[model samples]
Target: MSVTAPRGFRAAGVAAGIKADGARDVAVVINDGPSRAAAAVFTRNRVKAAPVLWSEQVAKGGRVRAVLLNSGGANACTGAPGFADAHTTAERTADALGDSAAEILVCSTGLIGERLPMPELLAGVDTSVAAAARDGGLDAADAIRTTDSVAKISFRRGDGYTVGGMAKGAGMLAPALATMLAVVTTDADLTAEQCDRLLRAATAASFDRIDADGCLSTNDTVVLMASGASGTTPDEEAFAALLAEVCDDLSRQMIADAEGATKSIAIEVVRAADEDDALEAARAVARNNLFKCAMYGEDPNWGRVLAAVGTTSAAFEPDQIDVAINGVWVCRKGGVGEDRSRVDLTGRDVTVTVDLSAGGASATVWTTDLTNEYVHENSAYSS
Candidate 1:
């Protein structure tokens, strides 16, 4: 299927001096007529961004016409002033779009604990709103990235409609919600509840399954909006399926772009007592740095996999476990079976499989390899 964005949405990105790098620091995405509905999920971190708190409250009503996003200032931990800045930003965009401030969602990313430069932000908002065009979606994607080497965007066309998204994150990413920021737009006809349901289910399997360093962020947010401009309404099941695919695509992109990551790892758990047990086992393996480093070095260390699983709640007998690395059966019946020297990690993708010999449930999680560069980059992040 050809990937494309829906009509009725225009995007623009402009630099307002928020970043010392002078990159695009603000973005605006506007939904024209037939403003569909919106739903969102944010970080569980108690130290939330002002924009996150503001958007969460606005999203409660399910109607949004625009989103104003800024990069290079997290707008977190600034107390009332930070919230005021978020409200001011939203109001600026709303005024430009002729929409109510409550109808404009806000998102921000970058170094935490600093106040936003309001003058520059307001200037960027004006420029973005004026530059908005249907083809400008990619620019908006670029504007929201920080420390990300490349902008992550995905679009899928299905049954006379389209779903498009842009995501940004390079560190502090883990399960429950990666340290990511995303804005997804669709022309499909869906109710607010339907959008929320689809997003939650999709995230559970995709974003919620990736763990870079087992560290969650204080600013992870995913906002999905439906513009209903396609004029073709899909059944609930079809919409859900399409939404899930879009989310999965973005999730994979996030993993592939992990900070200093050398390889993308897929951890699969099978023959578990239940789905939850399978997921628990998969997550444990995904978060293990030793397991990830072994994969990065092309070492078939099945013991790390076994150790990870043993730390989880998944019911399993050590003697009955089976494990594979890159389709090579390195361990069988809880013991080394094949020669570990045969495994290869010279490629950018790797897969590890584990079987519990318990029941029939299964799950898959995505992750990335740990490297010295990851440690170096994060150690001096504040400097």
Candidate 2:
């Protein structure tokens, strides 16, 4: 289940000698479309990667016929030559596919500073294009992973259309669109405007709510392409709901396979004065490293949660808040309610619920517990 799971798409991944161990490092995705409408979101980081810069222009036209991605080197902070490399890659891909260079998008991820090996990368692109097939989405997913333990893929079916996607993210996941590269494809009949709205709404409820390490990446990008192959135009509301469902599934997969993570945490904030308040409080708790570390240790340290929530101006009185861990009420009315010892955290999944007692608004943020493995992984990432 991946971007190729939708109609009119083919994908492939190949090893290009960019990674030291000869792992797959290059991927190609092609849309044989009747209508190649598209939309995209990029990292909000000011220091953008070369591919991100190029893709910003490509997506503005709201149509993409092909995408080339690599996982060996992040072409970031490399100045004009880096952008030239991205443009050359797009041109090469277009040449291989008999498409215009302007219809091709490029994406890359890895160490932030080094330039990509152009010769090897260009050769890899040729090989990836040659291998592109309808069943090659899994290989493409594998090819886009760095520091990730698994390839994330998801699928959702509508009345007569289907949405499928692939994602790679395990570290540097933060609120500014998360450090990841994701591609979603659909056979539904939709306009570019619909694609843009659906992508933004889905990402806001999914990727934008996750904070693994609170670090933004220069190469983070998510693209949604519509091929109009299914020949069925769905209701906008139903389309958005299904799109959000696929995004949520992918987000859960990303957290479950997070780098060096032992626990996947869900922080839910309820009873807030407004949706914005609920979202802010949930994000505050999700980004708290102290609370994450405590969660890793299975310590029912509700105080850490309270401290995080208090930092937000979410219109909640200290004495009116409540917290529950794993269905066990540990804090109530800003005081101890149940025995903290009764809360369990033995499983890989943990849920923390906070009640602001202000209103009925609610929100959820997905996060991962902090651990020594995370530190070790990041410490040796470049080596």
Candidate 3:
């Protein structure tokens, strides 16, 4: 169970003939809520997708009755017609659930610079809405995959409530937001303000801490909807922690299933001047192509890590920095410590730790190793 694990929510997925193959490409999630409080985070990319632009306004209202998502056309960079398609999708969803268009949120993911198949997509909305049921979350999750090999879903049971979510991403995963689409639902009693604050905090700690290829997506969107069906008002701190755990689980799944990735790497930065400095240093290392390629080749190249960190504006001195690969201190005091050959990178997971020697603050960013297949998959993506 994912989104539908929570009470007052129903979901469904249906094939809409959007993708070349007859795969499920459209999904609908409806909140039959006593309270329809909702909040969302979208890609910060300046070249916004039509669905992102539409959902931003709906999210601003702090309430949503339903969300419709499709996974074959990004509907980005398609000019005015793209916006109209998104608007029509929302309006049709609102009509199905007896609500206003402003109360429906829309999300899309796939190739950019293309228009959505409106006829098929509108028909899909009708079918998905009609088929929505409490156990349809698995289908909904499955419908939102492009290059993903598996559907990402997570759920956590809290005191008298449940938080569940589903997400999809395979490439172009970067900072400010990954190239992804996520929908999270909860049955706990919460206000729109609380939902907004909790969603932002959870994303800052999870989704914002991952980088795959350093390419931001125009269609990235994550939404949190509260139904208030549990009749339990959870402690803000506890709920935020649960939400962060769910988001983190989905984020790791994205990296593990990243397009053509062989190794899941964690860049941990410690002893920075502040949290921001630590994040900056870690993200720089995570996005460095040389560092990623080194990991893919099973080489513990500490110099690449140091060079990447040096490009950051973080407060750190050259001689005081230390680098460790898979628990082996490969570089100490910015010089050589353990033999590079002693560092192991033979597994599917790798960890690179950097000691900034500035303060007590720390952060970790997750990423994947670059490979030849990554280049091949992306080069032929539009084909």
Best by lDDT: 3
Score every model by TM-score.
Answer: 0.95, 0.97, 0.98
Q: Which whole-number lDDT from 0 to 100 does residue 307 have in model 2? A: 99
10 residues in a row with least lDDT, candidate 1: 170-179
| Model 3: colliding residue pairs | none
lDDT per model vs. reference: 0.83, 0.89, 0.91
Candidate 2 residues lying further than 4 Å off, grouped into runs, are 171-178
Tens digit per residue, CA lDDT, model 3, 153-239 = 999999999999999996443222235899999999999999999999899999888888878889889999999999999988889
Q: What is the overall TM-score of model 2 with all chains considered together?
A: 0.97
Error of 3 at 117 (Å): 0.7
Report residue 22 deviation for candidate 3 (angstroms). 0.5
CA RMSD (A), model 3: 1.9
Q: Which candidate wins on TM-score? A: 3
Tens-digit per-residue lDDT, 186-272, candidate 2: 999889888998999999998888878878789889999999999989888998998999888888888888877889999999999
lDDT of 3: 0.91
For each candidate, C-alpha RMSD in Å?
2.4, 2.0, 1.9
Query: How do the residues 138-179 of candidate 1 rate in per-residue lDDT, one tens digit apiece?
Result: 888888877777888888878988888888885433222235
Q: Rank the candidates by TM-score, best first.
A: 3, 2, 1
